[model samples]
Target: MGEFELIRRYFAPMAKATKPALDGSGLLLGVGDDCAIQRVPANQDLVFSVDTLVEGVHFPLGYCPRFLGWRALAVAVSDLAAMGAQPVCFTLALTLPAADEAWLEGFAAGLAEAGQQFGIVLAGGDTTRGPLTLSLQVHGTVPQGQALRRDGAREGDLVCVSGQLGDAGAALEFLYDTAPATDAASLLQRYHCPQPRLELGIALRSMASAAIDISDGLHADLLHILRASGVGATIDLAALPLSPALRRIKGGAAAGFALQSGDDYELCVTVPEQRWAAASRELQQQLTVIGQVQQEPGLRLNADAGMVYSQRPGFDHFSIT
Candidate 1:
């Protein structure tokens, strides 16, 4: 199919599928237009983020198209979750080496599924011929003056993370290693289809002193909050949450995954000591207090033996060998 035909057949339908959610809403015009028009609701501010995933750099060259479609959008929307914003809509710019009909079908299906799952609509986008790449821009809405930020953390705030960590990291390690292992399905799922913690973020809008999604490793992403808020943190290594699947691995390996692995799309939040009870009650079993914010201006790790220092923070795009 030609470029226009490819878009009309696959992408246009995905945009139209969101019509029910956008009808008479903020989305004035969606796909098939020169520009998508949207109206921000009163007393609300719009949040925007863009992310790109390139084959061989972000994922394996022969990765599953469906999972790639879901992950490409999920990572971008995780930024909105960090700000405690409800998803509005998104635009996808897709570059493909070739318009393989089967691949496009699976990709469109996955993209549409994600939109439905997240309650976001595909508004508009562009398609071009190139080495495989996917770029997505997502928009979300949050109440004025209530958006969560990394800079809002303060000393004495309780550090918390939603859900388990290290599963995705473990999955990556297993994929790259020659180790023989059964029952990798769960870990692979975690790596491929990350669930963005949008609901938890919304719930913490008033409760969290600061918040960030763990797109990078906890060590690196937490430092972002510390640097922005001009504070420090003390992480209890023993307290880091690990999934049962990850726990099946060696403890030291799991800890390394939790500390240095990226792409776990979970939220790390800071709650005031006094507010911890309330936040804990609100989040129920999903929240785990892993540490505390400190007045000092660097990260410290509390281990069983003694305090340790982090040698590397996270995956640096420029520093990757």
Candidate 2:
């Protein structure tokens, strides 16, 4: 099939099927155009971010296209979630080795599924022949001056994280293994599909002083916030939220996975000392306070102030290979 024809046959339908905005908002025009039109509300600020996934580097060759489609967009949209933005629409740029109808159909299905779940419509995109890669740009909006940022952390603020960590990192070990480990399904699910904590992000707009999605594990991602905010932190090693599945799979090294492994996709937030109680009451147990921002210049564990962290801090695409 030709390029335009392929788009019409697979992708165009996605925009048409997307859940329309309630009260007629956001995307003014989508797909089937030279440029997709968006109408950002006057009172809200526009937020957008791009993420790209190369086949071999990001996922295994011949990975499930359906899972890849969902993960790629979810990963990108996590940026909007971190900013506490309301998702609007997304544009996908897909490069494939060949126009495989089966793969395209599966991918489109998964992308459509994620789009509907996130309340994001398909704007427009490009498809081309290449060594399979997927790039997504997601757009969102937030109330003026209400968008969450990573540079607002204050000394004595409680550092919190949404949901459990380390499951996805533990799952990485079983990705290609024919023999599945204990509780592999639970761990693998975390890796293959991560739900962006959009609702939690919105909730944090008022409650959190600083926020970031935990894409690069708690250690690395939280450091970004500290560096941005000119602060330091003291994390309680016992407080890291390692899932039971991760504990079962990783044995004694579960804490390392929780701290050093990547792709958790949870939100790391800093709540002020005074409002931590209110934030706790609102978010309940799903949000865990594992640390506290301090005036010191570096991160340290509560147990050991001067000990080394890990052999490798976290996932660094360039540094790993």
Residue 90 lDDT, candidate 2, scale 0-100 = 94
TM-score result, candidate 2: 0.94
Q: How many clashes show up in model 1? A: 0
Candidate 2, pairs of clashing residues: none
Cα lDDT tens digits for candidate 1, 1-321: 799999999888777755534335567789887999988887899999999999999998788788888888899899999999999899999999999999999898888888889988899999999999899999999999999999999999999999888788778756654453664667877898999999988988988999999988899999999999999999988899887777677455566558778889999999998777755555757789999999999988877654233568578898866
Query: Candidate 1 overall Cα lDDT vs. reference?
Result: 0.86
Per-residue C-alpha lDDT of model 2 across residues 208-276, encoded as one tens digit per residue: 999999888888899999999999999987788778887776666677558887888999999997787
TM-score of each: 0.94, 0.94
Candidate with maximal lDDT: 2
lDDT of 2 at 141: 96
Model 1, 54: alpha-carbon shift in Å? 0.6
What local lDDT does model 2 show for residue 51?
A: 94
Query: Model 1: which ten-residue window has the lowest total lDDT?
Result: 17-26
- How much lDDT does each candidate structure score? 0.86, 0.86
